[model samples]
Target: MKINNYQNKRDILIVDDLPDNLRVLSEILIERNYQVRKAINGKTAIRAAQLSMPDLILLDIKMPEMDGYDVCKELKSNKKTAEIPIIFISALDDTIDKIKAFEVGGVDYVTKPFHVEEVLARIESQLTIQRQKKQLQKEIEQRKYTEEILHQSRAVLSSVLNSSLDGIAALQAIRDNSTGEIIDFRCLIVNPVIAKVFGKNKNDLVGKIGIRKIIDKIDNNLFNSLVKVVETGKSLSTDLYYQCDSLKYWFHFIAVKLGDGCSVTVKNITSRKETELELKKINLDLETFSRSVAHDLRNYINNINFAGNLLAEEINLDGSENEKELIDIINLSCDRTMSILEGITQLSQLKSEPIKPISFNLSPLVSEILNYLQNNEPRINIKFMIQDDVFVNADRKLLNIAIENLIKNAWKYTKKTDETIIEFGEIKSTEKLWQEKIKLIDISPLQFKQKSIYFIKDNGIGFNSVLEKELFTPFKKLHGDSDFDGTGIGLSIVRRIIELHDGVIWAESQLNQGAAFYFILATD
Candidate 1:
């Protein structure tokens, strides 16, 4: 049989042993625009099915070599052609045969001596039914694929949460059962590990707040992070080192953003933190040991060189002046080593000591420091402006050290006939922005009725302006040792003190012009 010339029509295989029947069916189907193929026997039909993969098969029950039942069985047995609908066409008009054909995977039957109109109608009806079945099967396959993806996604999320070394939780957006209002309070799922850590069951926590409410019960930081993640739908991560009972744990938690909710995981890094602390302790001990050895060596060398200088002075060397020169060299070297050792020891002390702050009157303290500096250097004139009745909360000793260093810096760097001007006062008002309100800071408390703005200006031989940032670093020298007669740790000490007091200090200078230092202390 030849196929009809139909555009995009479904391919059908007609299998019958009769030549007249095959010819008639082909001519009628060809006029109906269906692309049909023919086979005289079941063997030929199965061969054609494998070759062309027809969308439908029409088989005659009584045939030579192989019957239609065997052919339909073969087609239905194979996975490739099982879905193709099979309709039986035979002369026998028995209902038992129809049931048997249906059981063998025959979709419909056509009687022998078939009319052209009846055959075409049956063909059209079966084809329509087959198309619907194929569509339904396709939809079922697509549904299965979607379901597999969802299961894989859940498995991936579960593995990620379970494999985490830190405590983690996941929440979904659901309505509150009691209030009947939509809220981000439901726990869709939780891994087994988190359940064990929190001492809860995953089944019991399905509709709860997971670990967030549990943490809130214990007044933990997780509550805040959970709120932020839920409100903004953004990832929030932080390092939290906490102790439970006697065991210490360090956790870095990250909340990943998701639609309608978030997935949070925490990585426990207690071992890493312990390693860091152990390294820090070792470095501290080494630094302390180094400083101790340096101190003892400097003292011993200083004493030996001092005795050599005295002996060289007492003994007269008439022709050996080189021996005295060597003694002088030893003394100078010892002095330099002692100075360096002293600098290191002082810096170590600064790092070790805690800031001890107390309430004190800053006015009298500043005045006393200035008076002492003035008496020591009478050649250099001093212009002082002190803010009266000003008080602040700070360590008086540290503040004195800081102010004295600045004064000394001014004195050492100022040119000849230069005057140092020091003024003191408070920050008036500062404005801060917030989501709902603006905050204003008034420096009227602590009896500092007038906001203080302390400044030190000098007509000094200023150094390079490029070293502004490194000025507060220890041993960061701007002037040569031959020109300046002091250690370079002065500004560093000043910066440390200012930071301890929660204040800010900065310097402005130009090459050979002058230098000015400003200190702003928050009084309120």
Candidate 2:
């Protein structure tokens, strides 16, 4: 256990009439890293301590001027120093004096003709108790600070989130007190902004099911987005165009995932969303007009070529070859224009498409994808070791696209001397998740027949470990485009798919050594 910085040192004040007794006590305490403050008389002792406080006080019961009782009373009178522990050390054998010493705020008494061991033991015991007391004080202060922070945080967050015209809420998973089993999570806190959007009071929402319970009462589109944030554990900021009570309203929501909970702020973006829709509609009309114009021009060019053939039959042979060359150029230019238009249309379609999840066996998909790559490229010896029965509930088409991209890159980047190897399987255990996250996998779960881990290993030209963070980002390429031909979207897509399935993806690699992609596909 580690002690805090404030409570690391002990301070002891020894007040005695005898210089020899003070000297002996000082030596014993200073040897143990205690700061020793000495005073010859009661008056001097109080003055010495007032200048700098000590953790524990050792006062002589009998003194020449202003006895120990008077000194203890003065010290205890000041609120700044009242809590300090005072121990009486004296030659008085009478129980009445001992009782009087305690009445003046003394904690313990040391009988006269002090044994070195006895003094040391009592000092140790008092210091131990002082340490414990200081620790408890620190804990209480921390709890108070935490409560204050929570209170302030709740006020600020609620105020900011609820003020928006868009409905926003916070939700946490409720658990059973006895068994820790998850019960239904109800809304514990909500802001006024959320209340106005749903046409209800904040008090009525204390035990409700967040936005899910009243989405139809507010806006169904906003409800769907709230659901997305809960499932994904990712921040969502989007503009929604929907209707509530037969009146159209656009809401922009910014939701942050809080690990089994969430906090969202909604902004009334109705005007902005309406403007965006109008602009989009204008752009669509322009696109339709362009396509129509292109189609009309193609027809006009065809008619011109058809008429040019009739003119060729009636004209003389002079300049005929040049005329034919001009006609051929016109035809090729039209063809190129059509191809460019088609490609643009395809790119637009890919951009606007939504992501959908579909389930399929990954084992056959991996094998078939690898077989196709190997068959096309005979020189690359692709060795794949997939645990046969492995299956996952995810978007098969997207998974195939991601795996194929990784496999293709692996083949492309294989070192001349190294054999390309790929492996996959499932891992299911809390211990394994910790191990994989912290690089200290607990193999103990294997003895008890726990869920096994699944991983993907590959042997290819690896990059620096320092660059792993940016690897999954869109258009972030570790290797040059010429060295490995890619648009830099393969790993980005893979990460997106894994994220969609609520899984974690990480890479382990070193320069010149191969890399492995490890991911855990959490099952429901």
Candidate 3:
């Protein structure tokens, strides 16, 4: 129905030797919103008909170079323009001329000085017939395509059912006459695997006793599941353990509704189940050992810290310069070691913690972080640009930590520069952006789905491109600790947090020009 109303107007071509006739027909058709093309003679009319292929044509019986009858004959002979409807409009009213018009493939004849209403009525009737014919042709082609697809699908399904290793059976529901309840299931079809599992030939199993009779020997749950599938037309699956003839076994059963019955599949998973139990026991033992080691290490660090403090207090101002310097170095080393231990502990805890996502505005959070950084380093010229009301759904605490680490890293790297420029905002994904950022090789611009891409850009002494791949690896450092102070775990923690929220983060940078870190958060 929608297809029938696709086009708002039809196209008409009017052919005549007289200029006045062409002008009059063109004006009438154009006024009705029908596209009109005109030709002064039959030769031009034939060329126009072949080029544009108008829906309908009006031709004069008498024309220069070629008559209307000859033009119609040439058009009907060509396959490209054969189906177009043609109506003759001329002053000739003799019966012979009218007969000749019909013989030359004209659908209708309109005498000259014809009534305007009659001409319009005829055109509308011909256009309506043409539209219906086209619709019928489309329906025929669609039906053929659908039939071919159905045949292919059936072949694929049959091959899969016959070749599967798992036992498969198709059952038809047998209902009680009076109660309309599913009493049992009769085996309509069974693959070779199913026959072998039941210790019977395939031919002997088809159209045999109800499946309930066989399954009841092991467990009644299988029968009940089949009954449920029939009643609700929904699939059911379960793992079953049973013993038959002094042999123990485990089976995974699945029943799915099909037509008036259900199809069932059974797979033996005894070996896989045993392997899983063994692995679970091994993991429990490893967890206990790790806890014991961590407890002992914490105690040792605490005792060493206390002893160092006591030694510092006992050493007086009269002590040698070298002795004092060595004591100070020992104390600083102890503190640094403690800091590294704390970072590692936190990183490990993130793996076990569950994330709680909530909706919040990102703009205010970024503003707060910037304010804190600015207060601590008042002399640094740090500028930031953030969009307003940028909302996201994520774990607020984890996101806060990630953003803080990134901003701090930018600040530290840009310390040597005269002015530090840090910009935080959103940008749309377009074809041009995709070409400019070649690192995004896997993502297409069309797949962005209108989601915002947020980035933090800074003018800093960026790292070498060769070491970019190791930026997110734990304890991976490109520079010496004295040059830049960090535990080398900040980016790794940031990456894990982003992954937990089903997001992505990547960076692009040059040696000393600048660096930009881009990320996307789940908006829904």
Winner by TM-score:
3
lDDT of 2 by residue, 1-524 (tens): 34553366688899989899899889888886777889999888777788888989999977887889999999999886788899898899799999999998988899888787787788888878978999999999999999999999988877776555556666765556998643444676677876776678988887776445565555556555655566677678776555667788777768776777677666787887788889989878877786687678667766776666655654436657777677666655555555445434433333334556655567787788778877887655557787786766665665676677666656666744357786766566556454554353232433324333456667777889999999887667898755665555667666666655555567778876877776654431
Give the alpha carbon lDDT tens digit for every residue of 381-494 in model 1: 667777786776677777777877887787777635356665655333242211111111222234322334466666778767787887888888888877776667778888
Could you give candidate 3's per-residue lDDT for residues 155-229 as a string of tens digits? Answer: 887688689888899999888899988888788888887776666788887897656777786687778877888
Better of 1 and 3 by TM-score: 3
Best by lDDT: 3
As for lDDT, the candidate ahead, 2 or 3, is 3
Alpha-carbon lDDT, every model:
0.73, 0.71, 0.81
Query: Candidate 3, residue 82: CA error in Å?
Result: 39
**Clashes per model (N, Cα, C within 3 A):** 6, 8, 0
Candidates ranked, most accurate by lDDT first: 3, 1, 2
Q: How far is 42's C-alpha from truth in model 3 (Å)?
A: 53
Q: On a 0 to 100 scale, what is the lDDT of residue 150 in model 1?
A: 95
